[model samples]
Every structure is written in structure tokens, then in C-alpha cells.
Target: MRVLEEIAIEDLGVIRTARVPLASGLTVITGETGAGKTMVLTGLGLLMGGKADPGAVRPGAERAVVEGRWDLTRHPQAAHRVDDAGGAVDDDGTVVVLRTVAQGRSRAHLGGRGVPQGVLAEIAADLVTVHGQSEQLRLRTPGKQRTALDRFAGAAHAGLLADHRAAWAERAGLQSEIDDLTARAAERAREAELLRLGLAEVERVDPQPGEDVELGALVARLGNAEQLRQAAQIAHDAVAGEDMETEGSAVHAVEQARRSLEGAAADDPALGEQAKRLAEAGYLLGDVATELSGYVADLQADPAALEAAHTRLAELGALTRSYGSTVDEALQWASDAGLRLLDLDDGGDRVEAMRARVAELDEQVASLAARLTAGRRSAAVRLSEAVTAELSGLAMRGARLEIEVTDSDPGPAGADHVAFLLVPHPGAPARPLGKGASGGELSRVMLAVEVALATASDDEAGSVLPTFVFDEVDAGVGGRAAVEVGRRLASLARSTQVVVVTHLAQVAAFGDTHLVVTKSAVDGDATVTGVRAVDDDERVRELARMLSGQDESETARQHALELLESSAVGR
Candidate 1:
């Protein structure tokens, strides 16, 4: 893996202004505490798409930005991503990835095409992983642990899981059918009572189309019977006659006028037509009077059964609120509930079927779980042995490691319980690493496990694991142990890029390339710091300072030169 170029970062938390150029091989960065050693890590983390830390924005700085230029031509996994996103590859076969973070906006680009944060994280997961000076807690979470174990187990179990789920679904479906049938066994009696009561209510009311409107009008007429009759008689008198026979008749006047018009029409044709129209109108008015007289005579109140029907309908309206939205909907709900009650009373056969299915599933799951447990047991031993070997190289000499497996009840993944145990020194009782190992010890144990698992994965898959970062793994160790750690890390780098942040001169000497991190005042600001890849002499000076506290001392210089020279010979 190679990082070709980078640009300046300004007012980004503690890093006032920093520019860095990366090299193809290992690069070690060393700096004093608060010299913004972590600022460099922060910048790298952002470029690699880690979570944004708003606090990382320099005090009073409006935004924080990190820009990186990585040459990804030879990166096997990165090549596929570039091609997939339809990005252009340069003539020199290099792909450029840029990440930027502002106050409220974060953006990424590949070959100048805008990409979302998720895409950058995906690519960055393959590029780098930051493990602090302590163990990574996220790796030990149950979900991640289960996933890691499954990934270690490989592809054969994928089909098995699918088949098991399908079988479980079939059994579950059958069980649901049985439950439904059984619940219907005793619902007949209730249903009959419900139907009879409902029918009686409906029958008593005998509601018809437009019944409410018609009955309302009838009730109003009956309630005001005498008043309505008197009004109608008055209307009859005005239209034709209420006493045409007993008094001077209005009809007689109309007939007399018609005679006058008939005489006039003999002289004028228009007056003869008018007289004809008047005679026709006289007959129509007499017919209307006969009808009105009969209608008024029959205006009597009905007080008997209208009240009874209305009361029955009121009961139905109340039932409408409790039972269902409407009469039809209520009837349907009752029907379903009735069936469920019946099944509960007499579904013996279906109940037996349900029991049989549960029993069968229990047996099937137990069998599959046992097999899964065995496979995990075998895998745990191999993983533990490899990790133990790696742990010793990380300076935990004479350490005892174990993978303890316990039988758990059936679960979605499997039935074996797994945990890593450790004893730091000879004759010590083995205990879980979280309980037994110190911070540094736990860090080494985690590294061992990560390195081992990464080695066992497919080439494309392995490249994306958390980078095996050795942060001062050589703090308290040297000689053979320190050398071993370096060798193992170098070996890991062959498969996945390894980045180490260290204070140990021995570890810095082992790096294929060296970098020096420094702090300085920029226009009198305390936060200004910078980091850049160091040339041979600068690297020697840096390593010498780390080795002795006296960077300018001749003895420290000779020692640093010898260490670098020896590392080169060994490589």
C-alpha cells in the first residue's frame, strides 16, 4: 500500500497548520505529549472516514478539513471500488481520494466526483484502522464477536442457516394453523345467541329505505294535527272554495267573466281564444279543490307503534358504538369471534398436531445446534493456538492462552459459548483477558486475535480488517521480544497495511520509513504543529532523541545509525 501525496490542514483543533507527504513503506511518527501527536492521528482518522469529532475543530475555528491523496493503482480492493463508482483512473494508474469535513458539512470525492460519507467509510475501512494505545472495546461487543466467529467459520453454514430458517417457518406456519383451528372449537353456542339477538333487534325495528326522513315528517304532521287541518282548509278556500256551496261562490264569478269574454270574442278573435283558455283553467282548479278537501279530512295523528320502532332503533345505534362501525361490520366481527370460541372447545386433533410439530422442531434444532457447536469447538482451538503464538511475539512471554467453550441453549447462530482466557506468566491461573490482562496486555491479545483472523480470511476480505496498529507495543520490551513484534508486524503488512504510533526507538528503527512530528509557534499561536516524512539524517536524529534524550549526542547518533543500518540489513 502507498500514500503518495497530501495537503495542508489549518486551524483543525490543535493542528494550526500541517502538511505531510507519505511514502510506500512503514512510517513512524514521534512527538512530545501535547505536541499534537494525536492531531496527526486525528487528521488520518478523518481521511480514513472515522466519526467526526466536532471538538476537533480548533477553538474559534469555523470548520475542520482533512485532505489526502492516496495512490490506489496497485490496491486490489480499491481498484474495484473506483471502477464500480465509474471514476476515471489517471494515466499513471493512480486514483485520488479526497475527504473534507466542515462545521456542518462533510464531503468526499473520488477523481473529483462527489461521494457520500458511507462510500468513504467503506473505502477507508480497507485503507486504515486506528487502534489507540489500549484495546479496542468495539471489537469485543457480542454482535461483533458473533459476526467474527461466523466469518471465521466460512461459507458452508450459510446454506445451512437458510435451510434451518425455512424449516422453522414451515413448522411455525403449521403451528399457527393448529392454534387457529383449536380456538374455533367452542364458538358455535355464542354465535347462535349473537345471531338470534341481532336478528330480533333488526326485526323489531323493521327499518326501510328513507324510513327516518319519512317518519320524521309524519311525526311532525301528527304532532300538529289540528293546526295543520285548519291551515289546509284555509288554503282550500283561497284556491277554489271552502264554502262555494254554502256562500257566494268564487267559481260562479269565474263562469260569469267567461260569458262576457265569449260575447267579446265574436267581434275580436284574440278575445275568443282567451275565453277558451279560461274555461280549461276553471276545470283544473275544481279538481285541485276536491283533492285538497280529502287530504285535510285525513290529517289524523298516528301515536301507536312509531314510538316503539324508534326506541328499538335507538338500541341498535348504541350497540353500533360498542360492537362495530356499522350494522354490517358488527355482524362480521361477531362471526369471527364466534368461530374462535368454538375451536377452543373441541379442537383436540389440531391441538395434537401443534404439539407434534413443536416436538419435531425441538429435535431438529437440537441436532443442528450440536453440529454447529462441534464445528465452533474445533475452530476455537485453532484460533486460540495461533493467537497465543502471536501474543508471545508481542512481548507477553510465557503467557498461557485458552479458548473455553460452554454449551448454550439453541440460538439463531449456534449453541456454543466462546471466550478467550489468559495467564500472563508461568504457573498463573488462566482467566478471561478482560479480568486478567492489563491495558497493554489486553491490547496485545486483541492484536494477536485480529492478526490471526485477518491471516485466515480471503485476500480481498483480509485487506479490509482493522489495521494491526501497534501503538507503543515495544514500550517495556526489547531484545528478542521487540524484534519478534516487528517481524510479525512486517509479515502482517504483506497482507494488510500496518501503522504504528510509537515512542520506542527500537520500534521506530524497525519501520521501513521514518517520520518526525514537531511543534512550533505560527504567528504566536500555541496550537500550531506539523508532521512530515523525515529523510535519513532527520530520521537518525529523531530516533536518537527517542533512544537517549540527547538528540545531538554523538553516542546517541551512532546508536541510532547502527539501529537503522542493522534494520536495513535484516530486511
Candidate 2:
């Protein structure tokens, strides 16, 4: 989709301020050593959220800045991600990404709005793939080989891989559950026994809600029975005396006053009302005396009953001290403990069920892993043939590429170990990629693998091949081999954008758009480099210089022209 359109870099490494243009074809950058060729890649890396190196800032500069423009006309997914990050896309479907490194701090901006560095990284992942010497080294690992194969396995195989991972995860969870249950078996048993003992004790005592409070009242009353009886008798005597005739008694006194008032009632109406009130008061006093006499009689202390109440109170007290602070609280604890004991009782059954499920998942995972292995093996052959075809065009004629998938212990991805093997010729033993290939061969192999993957990606639904950036892809090659490398890169550019930074003139001659990084010294002290697009004449000079370190050499210029003409013809 030609995702990266251009990049503007400032105060980064040996480059001061330069705007490099890009397009949808093979674009190559060439320069003398230390002419800031790496700075261009560094800038692109920063835009892709690579680690910021404060030391890369030019001397006397406060910070280094790199900004990029990306066109999203065909990348609706990336455009949506930009919106989700609170960034905007230009009217022409372009979004600007900026990265700045100052001192030890780095910041990123997208569409003129501040955003997280990770946002840039996430977007870049689907928009660009950068390969350098370090990336070639990383291709040595089996893990990377497997990943490459999986990417070529298409969507159906990817879905199968996902299902396998899900099954493996479920199995791991069930296994964990079984292990935990086994490890804590004794602990759970002890806990259950303690609960049983507590339940038994509670059942024996049979404490009720508020039972202790009631028992406390009964004990206090029974212990003071004699005093209670005496108090009641004195009150009864004061109210009614031994007989009704007792003069000092409240009932008698009230009755005498009522009679005195009644005798004078005929003299005044007010005296009649007072007499009626005194009569009512005398009746009320007599009722109180009768009730007090009943209470005194009922206050007899039964020692056997008092002793039984005390014993019951003591049992309730023990329960309060152990289980709760009160009888009601103790009862609540028993209720909760009963429910917990029910759960503890089912622990063994739970463990058994979990083990059964784990066995079921183990079978499912094994089947899925076997399928995954089969899928990888099937895809490996196709990928090997495709990459070998690519290698043939990259000047590795008769070199056969083989993808080896071997059995391995089941893992999250699958149960296969993938290796990229190279058979130099028909009789040669198939050796691993990094082990047998030279620098140039490895370079071509990496390129071939990328091309194979990119071609496969074109068929997948909704898949847009990202821009390919290769750093020093022609590390060790010359003559016809180098020309083949250039031709191969140019061919790859037909479907997508290809950017390569190299010192080889042969590789650079094939570029649709050629950029040259030129270095100059100011005041014979400060060094600066600038990247600019070159015309045909300038390109010839640049290629001549790269050929023999002399831009004006007639012989070098002739060879440069011949190389460019040959690459053009191949294109």
C-alpha cells in the first residue's frame, strides 16, 4: 500500500536537517562510509518506536527529531487505529508521525496530537518491515523460522493454531487445579475435622438466640430472692398494714381523708370533687398492696432451680468465649460454619471432576497439536519451494531451500520445530541456514524468505504487504551476483515499496528513485550530512564514487553506466 510516503529528520547522528522523499517502488540510498546512511534508518526506526538514543543527537543540538508521513487510503484498519488513539487523518488520507529524543526522554506525536510511543509501534507493525544485519542474525533461531512458516500457513492454519492454544490453556488450568487440590489435601482434611468438632460442641450445648441474656436475668433474681421478699413485704405493710384498721397505713389514711371530705361535701361542691379523688386514690393503693403481697409470696428461692440455672449459664458463657461474644453471635457463627463445612465436604469430588476434565483437555490438546504439526509440515514444503524459486533468481542457482519440521514437545504454538535448511546442490547435505550460508548467501536467503512470505501475504484476505526496508542487504557480493541481487530487489518492488541502504553500486543502480547522502564540514570542525534525490547525472556520479571512491573517474563512470544499463535491462 506504499504506507511510508516521506520522512524529515533533524539533528540525528551526522544528518542535520533533511527531508527524504519516498514512493511505491525500489528506492536505494548510497553514500561513502560515515556519510550518515545509518541515520536515515535510525530516523525511520524512531518513527516506528525504536529505542531512542540520546547520544545520536548532533553535538550542540538540544534534541533529535524524526517525522514521517503515511498514506492510509487503502489501510482502513490502520486509519481506525489512529482514530482510536485520538489522532486524525488528513483529508488526503495521510497521517503524520513525529518522534523526538531530548536528553534521556523521548516523545511521539501522531496527526499533530500527542500519543503513546506504543501506538506508533502497533501501527508500524502492520505498515513496515525493517531488515538489517541484526535481523539476519535473528533468522538463525528456530522460533523465527516457525513464525515465518505460520505466517505462510494462511488463515485456516492460523485458526487451528489459535484453537490449539486455547485447548492447551484449558488443560494447564485444569492441571493447576488438580495440583492445588492434591497439595492441600491434608490441610483441607484438618480444616474439615476442626469444623466437625466445633459443630458437635455447638449441637451439644444447643445455645439459642438471646439465651444467655435471659439466663443472666434469672440467676440475678434467684440469688437475691431473700432481699426481694423483704422489700416486697415492707412495701405491702406500708400500703395496707397487717389489717385494714391500721391507721398509719397509706390505704387507711387515704380512706380516712375521703370520709372527712365526704362529710363536708354538702357545704361546698369543690369539697365533693376532692372527696371523689381521695376515694379513687385509696382504691389504687389497696390494689398495689395486694400485688406486692403476691410478689413476696412468689419470691421463694429453690436451690435446685438456682443451681441448674447457674450451670446452664456457665455452659452458655463458655460458648460465648469460644465462638462469639454473645449467644446470638455464636448461633450466627454456627450457621455460617455449616455452609462452609458443606463446601469442604465436596472438595474431594471437586478434585475428581477437575482431574477428569484435565484428562479430557489433554486428549483434545494432543489431537490439535498433531493437526498443527501436520499443517506446518504441509506448508513447509510449499514455502521451501517458493523460497527456493526466489533464491534461484537471487543468483543462488541450483541451491535448494528446504523447510524442515520436526517433532518437539507440545508448546503454546504447536509441537513442531521448524528449520530453514539450505542444500547448496543436489548431492550436498541439507545444512541449516546460518550454519552453511556465507554472508552474501545468507543475505539472499533472507531476501528470498521475505519475498516468499510477501507473495503469500498477497493472497490472504485483508492483508496489505508492508514497506520492505533492507539495510546492507548486499553485504558480500560482486559482479553478476550483485546484479542479480539488485534485479531481485527491483522485481520485489513491483508489488510494494522497497527501500535499501547499501554501499554496493550494483544494488544502488537498480533503484527507481536514488538518494545520495553527502557529508560536508563547516569551519573545518562541525560535520553535517544531507540526503537528497539525485538526477541521472548526479546518480552516475554517486554510483561512480561508490564504485571506485572517485566520482570523476571516467573509467568508474563508464562501469557505473554499464551497471545501471544492465540493471535497467533486467528490470
Candidate 3:
């Protein structure tokens, strides 16, 4: 079974170094006043990621360390989480958790790897449940009472709560959407009008892709048409003169050079190669001269065409200034605005649809909340009967607990509030637990409720926690009542490990394993404490000390022996 195998502490408070071994059944830790019994729980608190106090460190020590070993063979999920955190569980299914407090800071480790203190807290939640005086105080709150009732309502009831929460979340989302649509109606209308006007302007201008750039080039050429024609004429005259025989013309000069090179070709082969190059050059010059003559003739400026182009370019520029840097970008903006306007126009229809959906969800939430309330009320009757039955054996004869489920405003957890009331005797009226119970009565009532829950719950909330630790939960109890407290603890231990730090020998006598915290003086004035298991004879002496201040008294020893025999028979 999953259990806390051992806890080892070093230099914490009065404890120098000690290892407390635990087992499957009831394990009791007992010691004299100021003998460092609380230090044992302090070490466990550190392992559970509880806040570290620098004052808890033993004087002259650098740091205090607490380590715990857990058997996780039956808890694969917890083991998997450790593995995910880069820690390893041993072959025998044991995981080691260590916490160290130095100065004012604390550090935690799982398996062999370092981890956040919160990691230890999360993993340990499923491994142990610690019940102390503080827990009894917390049980008085309304929130804790409701949680306890819901847990006792079982798994099927839990599913109903989940469905209700989901429905509430969905309804909230729809309500938010409807609120937004209503709040921003005027703003959305203004946006739609602006988009419509802009779209109309863009449609009227209707600029084409690359149209502005193309028109710019045409305007430049037409503005300087006369100058361009003059340049073409001069270049044409230079390449192919006024007439073919014109002196110093490019065609005439190349023709003369070709003839001279051909005449010398007969005397030298190099001259023939030069003559072929001159002939190719003459052909290229003739082609250029023809193109230049044609260009001069066709290059005429048209005022009407120039005016039309200027007007179109200005229209495109207006569109660009308002929407984009270019005609194409402006066109893209127009297309997007058209779609946005359509969406704004449909807002009314969408809001109507959403409101209808929200109304439907309201009905669903109300129906589910009703079902949840009914289930809780039914479970309340059974839980009250069960806890009242347990209180009879915990020294509160004729006492009974009554659970009340009342209606509340519907929310994620459903529309119900739960409160636990106590009736001290048959003739007394039932009052809320906090008001009707004394300190001793409250402790027993809390214990009875816990025992009832533990035996009744088959859900993960009850089954996953493998160990329970009680720190003087039997406070203000003695004699017969003390024996019953021990017996109930022993009963709880049968299903899961139970560790009790107590002063009652009646309780200690029922432990399957008994450990006592012993104190000794060191050096001149320093004191150190250790925890050790007691055998049957040592247990008797320890019990005697608990019954009376003197362990050597014959009568106290006899009472201790009798307590052990009676508790054993009860177990």
C-alpha cells in the first residue's frame, strides 16, 4: 500500500538527528513535555512544503534538513509526475523527498533531483492529509462545510456540478457578447457610415493597377516632344547624312575604310580581317540612322491627350492620399472597407440571435441547478445520520448532527448552501456546529464527521490520500473518552496509515508501532532530542509516565498495563 515509509530530521529545533519509521497501521508518537515531540511534526511540515521558519533551526547549526521516503508502487500517477520532473523512483517503488532550511530560505528535492517547494506540495496532497487543531478551526467555515457535503454526494453528483459550471461559462460568454453589441451600437453606426462614403469615392475614381505610373511616363514624353524630335534629327543626320555622298558622314566614312582595307588585303592577310570588321560596322550604322529618322517624324505633342492624362493622375493622387501611397493599395483598402460595412450592417441580426441563445442557456442552467440542489439535500440526510452514529462512540452519547441544504443564487457550483448543525441531547434544539459545541465537543464532532466521510467516500478525494496525521486531535479528552478516540484512530488506520502525536497512554497503547521522543543534555547546557521505537516493556514504562508523572509508581504501572490490555482487546 502507498504510505510514508520514514521521516529523517537533522538539526531542527531541539531535535539533533532522528529517523522516525512508520508502517501501514496506527503509529503513535509520544513524549514528555518540552521533549521535542512537536519537532517530529515540524519535520513532516517541511516535507509537505509548509513555510520554513529560521527560528526553528537549532542554535549553532548552519541548516536544518528533513527527508521523507514514500512507497508509491500503488500510485503510478504520482510516480509519473516525478519522472516528468526528471526524478527517478527506486526499483522497489520508493520515492525520496528532501527539504532543507538555511537562513530564511528553503529548498526541496524529489527523488534525487531538485524541485520547487510547490512541486512537493502538489504531489504530497494525494499522499497525506494532516489534521490538526487548525483543521478543526477551518471546519467551522461555510466554504469548508459546502465542500465536505459535495464530496460526500459522490461521483455522479460531481458530474452534475461539472455540467452546471460548463453551462454557466457558456452563458457568461454569450451575455458578454450581447452587452458589447448593445454598448457600442452608436459607435458601430458611425463607423459604417464612414466606410460607405469612402467606398463610394474609391468607386467613382476607379484607379487601375500601375495606371498612375504608366500615365506619368506618357506626360513626361509629351511635355518635351519638340526637344525629343530635335535630338533624334541631329543623331539621324550624323549617322546617314543629308545625302548618301555627304562628306564626313558615318556611312560614307565606313564605306571608304572598307575599300582601303580590301585593296591592301592582296598584300597582307591581316588587312583582309580589318576590311570584314568595317563592313559589319557600316550595316549597324545604317539600321540606327533609319530608326532615328522614323522617331523624329512620329514624335508630335498632343495638348488634349496631355490634359486628359494630367486630370486622371490628379484623381488617382486624391485616392492615394486618403487611403494608400499607390493606386493598387488604395484599391485594396476599398475592397476591405466593403466587407467591413457588410458586417456592421448585420450587427442587429447577430445580437438578436445571441440573445435568443442566452435565454435558452438560462433555462438549461436553472434545470441543472435544481437537480444539483436535490442531490445535495438527499446526500445531506445520509451524511447526517452517518456522522451522528459515529459521535455516539466518541463520548458524546445521545448527540446528533443535522445537515441543512438551503437555496442560494445560481452560480458555477450550483444554487445551494450547506451548514452542519449539532444537537447535544434529545431535548435540545439543533444549533450550528460552531455555536452549539464546546472545545471538547467540537473536536469529537470534527472527528466523527471525518470518520463518516472516510468510510462512505469511494471517490478519488477520499481514496487517493494514503496517510492521515492527527496532532492532538483528542485535546480536552481523557479516561474513557480518550480510549474511544484511540480506538477510532485505530479503526481509520485499518484502511490507511494513521500517525498520531498524542499525550494519552490510552491512545498510545493501541498503536501497532509506538515511538517516543526522548531528550538528553549535551556539552554543558545544550539539549538534544531523539525519536526511538519502544518495545513492549519500554512501552509500559512510557505509558506509566503518561498516566502519572512518576513512571516508578506501582499503581501507575498497573494502570498503564491495564490500558494496554484493554486497548489491545478493543483493537
TM-scores of all predicted structures: 0.64, 0.78, 0.81
* Clashes per candidate, residues 3 or more apart or on different chains: 15, 0, 0
Instruction: Report the backbone clash tally of model 3.
Output: 0
Residue 165: error of model 1 in Å?
A: 9.6
Ranking by lDDT: 2, 3, 1
**Ten-residue segment with the worst summed lDDT in candidate 3?**
457-466
The residue-by-residue lDDT of candidate 1 on 437-475, one tens digit each, is 776566667667666776775621333344444566555
Which pairs clash in model 2? none
For model 1, where is the 10-residue window of minimal lDDT?
459-468
lDDT of 3 by residue, 61-93 (tens): 999999999899888888998998888899999
In TM-score terms, candidate 2 sits at: 0.78
| lDDT-superior candidate, 1 or 2 | 2
Q: Where is model 1 more than 4 Å wrong at Cα?
A: 1-13, 19-27, 42-129, 133-150, 157-214, 221-364, 392-400, 409-413, 423-429, 435-440, 457-470, 510-514, 550-555, 565-571
Give residue 129's lDDT in candidate 2 (0 to 100): 89
The positional error of residue 129 in candidate 2, measured at the CA in angstroms, is: 1.8
